[model samples]
Target: MPRGGPVPEFDTIVIGAGMSGATAARLLADAGQRVVVLEARDRVGGRMHTDRAAGFSVDLGASWIHGIRDSRLWELAQALDVPTIEFTVGSFQAGGRPIADFDGAGNRMSAAESARWVADVATADRALEEAISRSAPGDTYLDVTERALDALERREDALDPERIDEIREFFRHRVEEQCGAWIGDLDAHGLDEDAIDGDEVVFPQGYDELPQRIAAELDVRLEQVVRRIARAADGVRVETDRGVFTAAQAVVTVPLGVLKAGAIAFEPSLPAEVADPIARLGMGVFNKVFLQFPERFWEDGVYAIRALGEPGEHWHSWYDVSAISGLPTLLTFAAGPFGRHVQTLTDDEAAADAVAALRRLYGAAVPDPVARWITRWGEDPFSHGSYSHVAAGASHHDHDALAGPVDGVLHFAGEATWGEEPATVGGAYASGARAAERVLGRPVDLAAFAEGIRRSEV
Candidate 1:
C-alpha cells in the first residue's frame, strides 16, 4: 500500500519522447502551455540511439538525415553546430564480383552494358507503371515488380535466366531497402509516392542529439510506459506504469508498430476511422549489424557493397563505414522478412554470418571482426518494428486517417502519420509541429530553426 497523491495536471501530455513527441512538447511549452512528455524508454531519443564503440559514434537507430534540401533535421544540426557529413553510395557488388559504382544514375555498368541496362530498366519501369495502374485493389508491389521483370525478360531475349534472376533480386532488395518492407507486403499504388529531394547526410556526433537538443527545456518523464488514454468530458487522462496524469489534450507519437500492437488502450475505444487505418497500415523491420575490424582490408573508396544473395537474404547489402567514419567498421542491413529472421539469430551467429559474407567478397583470409553490434528493432518492445509502410490494400489516405485528430482531445503525430514523407526523421518532426499547431490553433514557425541548414549548405 502507498499513500495517495494528487494527479499531475498539464495543458497537454505528449507520449513517446521521440522526435515527434519532443517537437510537439517543445512547441507547446514555448507557447507557454503546461506540457509534459512521457517516454516509455529510459532515454529521450526513442528510435534514434547513438552508441559509442571502437572510437566512433555509431548510430544504432535512424542514422541518415535524409533530404538535406528541405530537411528540418539538417537545419537543426546546423543551428546546434552538430557535425554531419555527406553520405554517398560508392561501390556495389553482386555474387562476389564488383558490379558497378554508384553514379548519379542508379546503375553501374560498361558504356554498352549501361545503355542496354538503362533502356531495359526504362521499359520495365513503364510496364510496372501500366501494371500498377491496371492492378486490382489487393495487388501488391511484389506483383508489379514481378510483372515488370517478366515483361523485361520477354522483351530482351539476350537476357539469360541468371541475368533475369539477378535483376529481379536487385530490384527486390532495392524495394525492400527503400520501403522497409518486402515488396509482397507493400502497396503497389503507394510505390508511386514521391521522395523528398535532397542529398543524404549522416550525423557524426550522433542522431540522438537532435531530439536531445529539442527536449533540453521540456518536461520529459522517461521510463514511463503509457498504458491507457481515457478521454473524458473535462480532459484527457493518461495512465502510465508510473502514475496517472491529466491533460487538456494529448499527443500520441508512438511508432505505428506499437499502435498496431494495441499496447496502449484507449477508453471509449478509438473511432473506426482511426482504428481502421491502423489495421491497414503495415510496420516494417530494418535491422543493422555493425562490426568493427582491427584493420581496413576491404577495397578503399567503396561506400556500399551489395552481395548478390537471394531475394530476401539478410546479407544482401553492406555499408562501408570506414569510408565515412574513418573507423574500420562495416555495417550490414537486413530489411523486411529477412530483418526479422536475422533478429532470431544470436549475436555471435549474426556476427559470424556477416564475417563469412565479407570473406566471400574480400577473400577467405579476411580477418575476423573484433567487435560487433546488432540491432533487433522487431524485438524491441518500445519500437516493435523499424518503421511504417503502406500495405497491399492501403493507400496514402490511410496515412491521413491515422494522422487525423479525434474529438479535439487526442492528436497523433509520427513518421507513419506523415503523408508525403513517411518513415523519415523530417517527416516525424513535421508531423509533431503540425500536431502542436493543431493544439495551439495557430501555425508555428519552425523555419527559423532550419535557417542554419540552408546557410551552412551554401
Candidate 2:
C-alpha cells in the first residue's frame, strides 16, 4: 500500500548502511518502495570497513563468514559472485593441526603438550556444561567456572591446580575472543543457544565487498550521523548531523554499541520493553593488531604461533596470513579486558607490547614490523564496541525484544537484534531483511530476492 499521505521523500528510511541496513533498503527498494539509507561513516560497510592504505586490503572489522548453510550473507555472496576461501574445520586455523606453541623462554613446547592442553579444553567444557545447567540467570561463566573446575579437581583423575588454571585461562581467552567480552561478564546460560554450525570462510577480496555490493544500488547517504528520531503519527522524523529526513517508516540498524551509548535520541523514549534489552545486553571490545614484516622469520607452513605464560596470554594467539595475500604478515587479536587495556595505550605502546610478545616466542630474531594496522573499535564513535553479547542478567529474549517494532513506524534491525546469530554479518543481513519485511507488511525471503539483487549488479 502507498503511504497514507503526500508521498514522502522516501517511503522508508533505513539507518546505517551496514549489512543489516543495506539488506533492508535493498529489499524495500526491490519491492518498488523508495528507500534511503543513512550511514554515519563515509563508507557503506559500517563495521565491515576494510583498509587498503597498507597497499593491500585487510579487513579492519569483521573478517569471517562464520557459517555457510544457514547464512543469509553466504547466500548473498554466492548470488553476488563474491569470492571467499574456506578455512576448514581440520585446518590449522581452527586448532586441528598441531600448534606452534612456545613457552616464555622461546622454547617450543612439544606437540604432545599442545595436544594435552587441547584435550584439557574439552575436559573443561564438560564441566562448563554442568555449570551452565546448574547456573542461574544472573550467574556468570567466571563464577561457575570456578565451582565446576573445583569439582573437576576434586576428582581423582584431575590435573594439578596450576595446570587446570592454565587451561582455564586458555578457555577464558577463547570465550572472550568468541563473545568479545570477559568471561566474568558473560551469562553462564546465555551462550547455550549461540552456536552456529557450518564451515567458516574469509574474503580474499576483502569483507567490505559484501556490504559495498549490497549498498551499490541503494540510495545510501554516507557521513550522516543520526542524532535524533522523533515519532510522527504516520511516520518518523529522523535528524542527523547532515539533515532531517521524514519517511513513512524507518529501519534503525545501527550497531548495538551505538544504541547502548544513547548516541541517537528517540523522542518520547523507546518503550521499556526495548529500552530494557538495550541496557541489559553487553557491548564487548575485540581488537586486532596486524603486522607486516619484511620477510617471514617464523617456521614455514605453520598457521598459528602461540606464546604461553602469565602476562602473555592476552596476546597469545597469532596467525600467519602470509599465505592469504602473499605478504609476510601476521595478525593477532586482543579481546575482553585485555582488548580494553590495549586501547588505553598509545599506538607505539601497543605495537611494542605485540612485538615483545612475538619476541618471547621467536626470540630476538623477530624484526620490527614494516607496517602495522591496529584497531580500537571501542573508541570509534560510530561503533563504540566490537559486538554485543548476552550479559549475566540478559537472555536471548532480550534480543527478540530489541527487534520488536514500535508504533508500526519505527523498526529495529542489526546483528544484536538477531537472536539466532547475533554479532555476525549473516545475522545483520537477516535482521535487515526482517525489518524491511515489517516495513512492507510482507516477506521477501532470501531466495525470492537473490535474483533481484544479482540483476542490480548490472
Best of the candidates, lDDT: 2
Candidate 2: which stretches are off by over 4 Å?
1-7, 88-94, 104-106
Candidate 2: tens digits of C-alpha lDDT, residues 1-458 = 13465556778999999889888898898889988999998888889988877566898899888868766788778887888887532221225754587754557878787777677767877887898889875899888888888988989998887678676777687667778898989988657765656888888779988778777888888889999998766888889987988888999998899999999999979999999999999999999999889888888777677765564577888877775677999888888989999999988889889998888777778999988889999999998999889998999878878987988889999989988888888888889888988888887878867777677766
Q: 266-306 in candidate 1: lDDT tens per residue?
A: 98799998999999999989888988888877666555665
lDDT on C-alpha atoms for all candidate structures: 0.78, 0.83
C-alpha TM-score for every candidate: 0.89, 0.95
Best by TM-score: 2
Q: How accurate is candidate 2 locally (lDDT)?
A: 0.83
TM-score of 2: 0.95
Clashes of 1: 0
Candidate 1 has a TM-score of: 0.89
